[model samples]
Target chain A: MTENNEYAVECEGLGRVYRSRSLLGQSRETVALQDLNLQIPKGTVFGVLGPNGAGKTTTIRILSTLLSATTGTARVLGYDVVKEGREVRKNIGIILGGDRGFYGRLTGKENLRYFAALNHIKPRDTDRIIDDSLAQAGLADQQKTLVEQYSRGMKQRLHVARGLLTDPGVVFMDEPTLGLDPLGAQELRQRIPALVGQGKTVLLTTHYMFEADSLCSRIAIINKGKLVALGTPAEIKRNFSSIGVIELTLNQTRPSLQEELTGLDGVKRATTSADGVYQKLTVHVVAGADLSDKIAEVVGKDHIENMVARDPTLEEAYLEIID
Target chain B: MRNFFVQAYLSYRGLFLWLNWTAYISNVVLRPILMLLMFALVGKFAADSDAAQAYMIGMIGYAIPVILLGGILQSFVYERVFGTISFIYSSPGSRVAVFFSRGVLHFPNSILACALSFLFGWLVLSLDLSTLNWWTMIVSVLLTAAACTAFALFLGNFTMMLGEFFNLYNAAMGLFLAMTGVIIPIASLPWFFGDLANGIPLTHGLVALRGAFAGMDIGAVRDELLLEALVGLGYAIAGIVVYMLVERDARARSSLERSPA
Candidate 1:
């Protein structure tokens, strides 16, 4: 058990490698997470941001005691994740998103009652705990409805309610708002701070930069099984303050233009996207470097309709780090 | 105890896909009856009424494993398919409670299947029940169901480990039908098969059941009953052990969410 209560989650040199063997007896190994370290403080919503296959889910799995770390140690709420798994499990709730993790035939309330029993909630307190969780997730009225009949948003809300059944001190949510409508996503996002306000620590993994920027107190961006950046959203953006983005609207796009812009000195990345009759070019460059002359030379000035230069957003910073 | 019953009922209702009245009636009720009728009719045509009566009782014994195995296996398979097995493992719940509760409802379902087979034999085939020792017969059926359920739970671990559901189910069903003296007398078989029958569930239980139908007293089949209960207990303990081993292996392989093929 951890001696410090300030941090709800702590890991040092944590690593995991998956090995598989083919029918022909050839073996291969893939490193899913490598020498990763994180310390999440109590009562905060810490976000983990990464590209696909970037070890986000792997980290969550190790911390929640669903998988063991091959190398180092992880502690959750003062309990070792591997050695004291039951204690860790008792203090944590894991919400894996998607439509698959529920019993479609059972009503939402019945599902909660069943899980409550699995958590060994006192029989006398089961109903009240379930009711409080349902009301918290804003699904109190729809509790009796079969989960198969629920909309995706309702199912996601029910997932939230289920995670709260034990009233765990630490909650791990993986892409909680994935596949939700804008309004539904917003509603779920609004509940995060309320959880933190009640002294619960939340570890969230998401791909949405705007969502992380708005809700997370700190964010870690990992790529290819490595942590590339970690800090507050503003601090992450500020680390790239020396970076600037130039957006240009063109009448037409040519493949050669992208290569030409990327070849320019001080240019980090040049990407093009088609929007209706025009094309949008986003160029990331060093802040002080004057690439206007070189860019104008690559594409004729007459073809340039709109141009704007500004500091990079968190999304742009994440893209640059991932690249 | 509350958790045990709650988990049992919810898992059966949620994970068993054949819970609907129509599917339940067709699969659990009609299918077993059809099997009993077909086998009894074949035996009568092939030999005589005495042979037909033997086949009917054999079918009753066979129904225990058939119903219990499918019911218990389906519960584990659907839990993997629906991706709830990880939650079950990650919870702080007692593993013993969760493990045993899976077979709770299935045990009674198998007993119910046996009773239906016995009823069909008595009413349609004009089988004599007046000579049957009702007490011993009931105990035999209960013991048979318990033993088969325990064996099925033990087999259920392989479905998750091997990642194949129906293939394993078919293999086990074939093994039980052929090796457990379901339709054949162990004495007439080769010596090796007779020894094999001793380890398989439903073999001794069926013998005791037949003895009960012949109006034997409890003392006459006491050894068989004790062996049947011991077999059930052995499988139950083995199932729990194998479940913990599988849980450990799943954590090592990180394959809890990977469903059986």
Candidate 2:
């Protein structure tokens, strides 16, 4: 596996253990990544989905050579992440969810220029690279403005620009849509596929299920530093085909409603959504189980207006896998 | 070499241009002068005019290190606070090289601030340049700048490795200003401080600067220059070792996954 260069990234039993100090100086160790194995092929859009602390960022950082795994081996373009870290760094780029990556004091163009220099872009090629990146990020017009003056969305765009300054073969995007308005997130989302079209491998981690469902060619759902499921969206949903989905519209929803619904026999997961007047509840149950009567009994017929039994969605499949 | 200079220039422009000239001058120049003025006043009352002139030169010597210290603190803090450490560390560029590039970038400003401080001293304090040993004065000042910049690079790398310690930097600068013969002659102080002065970079540098301005021969000040150089070398080695250790730990522990900010 270590000898193979066919895959963009390959990890075999990679793990990271962190030791931190408490306020009273008590030492604690945290296992951020367990013995995880993944083989991400070239030019594919891979999505890693997990709740916070599930090791999504750890995996990305390790593969990007920003961090090293304490145990096992990982490789990027067949170069060991720990041993050939500089080579790995040269081949990859990363965009974090947080807005604190660039120098706010510098202009957008200046920031890109600086990163270009760091990347060792030839002096003659620096300006052209900066211009191309700024144009690609849609910041060419505003490139002269200080980054501090740019909006959060604009800065995020600039981040993507800097990430591409090196023209890396693989790009790791960790929750890129984390703190953006709907339109802003949608705009960034629209820009991702273009990278794929250019034959650049992209590894994206997002909490937004729809973002994963829409963008990823392959999605891996992780929980507690373990890979719970890895497959295409259709394949993952098909694997959970035995889990039936029941939707209910009730007059009022209580926080305990999900817990009560999960308590019913054969029900694996339950979630609630509110839309102004109606409270929408979704439950995943075993396909053969008779959940209809119990769901009605739990919600009461007076409170239940509408109910629909259907197949599980990508999100329901994800929840069922994680659960 | 080309990449290094480019990065250095970028670091300089990114940092210094952020603050307007007025703010830069007032903070970097005016504050140090005010501190010097207090010492100058003391020199006038407690000692003769030559001592006063020595105070002026010493005050000028103190300003560059202060600027260098400030620049180091700001650059390291900016990366950590702005969450750019991961971006920089992940780059293909050598981390040590990047650290020095920023340190090098701040050198010119340090030089400029020191030059302005001296100009202010010459005009306001009635300083006479002809009596000074021009060769010794030039050599000492340049060597001091080199030593100070090296020390600042050490601090920058240390902060990068640890991910915090702006307070430590503050304490260090304070100690340098108070105890490095900048405001007080080491010989006049108690034996411990005077002995401790040999270990700090600015001590020998400042001592050599005073000797130069008092028309001391180059041969007479060679020992001080050599000591200053040795201190700078010690800091360079320490900084490199600490930075590499921290970098190794960061890799093993995956600290970048946990945001320092």
Candidate 3:
């Protein structure tokens, strides 16, 4: 179920700003987010993909109801995050700004118990929740060990367990794998989607593109407090997709071809590679024009070989979209 | 309300004391033995056990305020500055379950730590706590904790670091030394100085706290006892109100962004 209609989270112009003194001791207003609109469909893992400081944390903060929107309105699970905050908190589970919600001295079992009590689980039910949570967190064996002793990866796992403590309809994980070892990072990437498999909606934010590609059902990329792109990974890639690349391997230094290739009617752009034995040239032609024929006839078999035409990658499209 | 403090107390109870004590609290357990050696060497200490016993009782009275300030209230500061406060804040239950909710748990922590430290001091100094009125002493210890927790919580509002806790601790202790009759009795001081001490919460608190050390009837010190409890509770509530306002600004969130408050 798409969270848009089932609507786990919806935002209309959410924003956050911080006022800080600059290096020169000048007061400056840094707008972390501004006029940003967003929607996360229920049961889907919606990702907020952005470079660091793209307001991902700020956005997650608002939707999780840990934050109140300065200007716009946001709702989580049909509850207005600002006005009906208690209900919003009831519907969504959040692990925002990474590992901010844990006590170091409490053992894994104790930590879960404390959080469960605060979440209002009845005394008898709390024991079951703690048992289930320690197991779910994969900290079952180490449940008796204090949180301070747990490695960074283990703390993150506990954070996920705590997020699921309420069994809410929607969940939020910010930088889900921010400071994990490769194995741990990969482990978290898999663990996140399992919540969705059980029909829980997830809203996640990450700086890793691969994480988004591997996990998100749809993504919204915010740049400088604005929504730069919003769509499915495939759909977004297609929006900026490009084709027609001519790759070449050459032996000689041809500085003169720079002008000839640049001025050519079929060639769009040309640049020499570091090896001096390779050149990559791309051409965007007027639809009716034939550039392949021009390359074969004009460039003359001497310098060009390993020539290939291919569609651009999502990586390239993402760069082009942002640039 | 009961559950809130239960969570807060249980959440923080042993961890903080263990944290401070494991480092030096217990390591100094032998200090009283060392002091006994000195007392044996000094003629003024007396061969009579009462002199050595008085030293222990006095030590307990002195350590009460120090442990109260450092052990609990400081830990609360760490809990917040380190971000564990957010964990508690996210929960649905009352933040005001007093001690359990951690809304004003600091005052209680300080008070309880004071009692614990005094007990430690008693054993170390070879004091005669054996004849002490257990019930009255317990009440005094709790009152001392409540008062100090309020003080620490009040000071915590001004800074974000545990170092700030020390700053507040030192300032309060200096003021405390003259008031609690920990050093000299406030009654011995000149009238102006005595009046300042009389009005302070610690003054009223120590009146009860010191009475417990004397093995006296604590509840009978009625008016001063009630006044101190009211003052501690008042400070706690007022401190919480200030914290709520200041912390709201600190949280800022998007609400602050749109409103710029």
Candidate 1 ranges beyond 4 A from true positions: A240-242, A246-263, A270-282, A287-309
Between candidates 1 and 3, the one scoring higher on DockQ is: 1
Kindly list the per-residue Cα lDDT of model 1 for residues A80-153, writing each as its tens digit: 98889999999999888788778889999999988999999998999999999889888899999999998888
Q: A1-323 in candidate 3: lDDT tens per residue?
A: 12345677888877877777779999998888998877777789988866678788888877766665677888788777767877776676777535445677778888787777777778778888878877866779999898878887788878878888888788888886776778868877787778888889888888777788778899887777778888888776655334335555555445666566657775555556755546654443332345776665556677666566554444544555555
**Model 3 alpha-carbon drift over 4 Å, by segment:** A1-5, A22-25, A97-101, A240-311, B1-6, B13-21, B24-59, B98-138, B153-164, B187-199, B209-220, B253-261
Alpha carbon lDDT at A88, candidate 2 = 89
Docking quality level of the chain pair in candidate 3: acceptable
Q: Write the per-residue lDDT of candidate 2 for residues A253-282, one digit (tens) a residue.
A: 777888888887798878788767898888
Give the top-scoring candidate (DockQ). 1
- Alpha-carbon TM-score of each model against the true structure: 0.93, 0.89, 0.77
TM-score of chain B of each: 0.96, 0.89, 0.65
After TM-score superposition, what is the CA distance of residue A129 in candidate 2 from its true location, in Å? 1.6
Q: Which ten residues in a row have the lowest lDDT in candidate 1 chain A?
A: A235-244
lDDT tens digits, residue span B20-94, model 2:
788787867786777667767778889977777878888888877888777765676566656767777788887
Which scores greater on lDDT, model 1 or model 3? 1
Docking class of 1: medium
The most accurate candidate by lDDT is 1
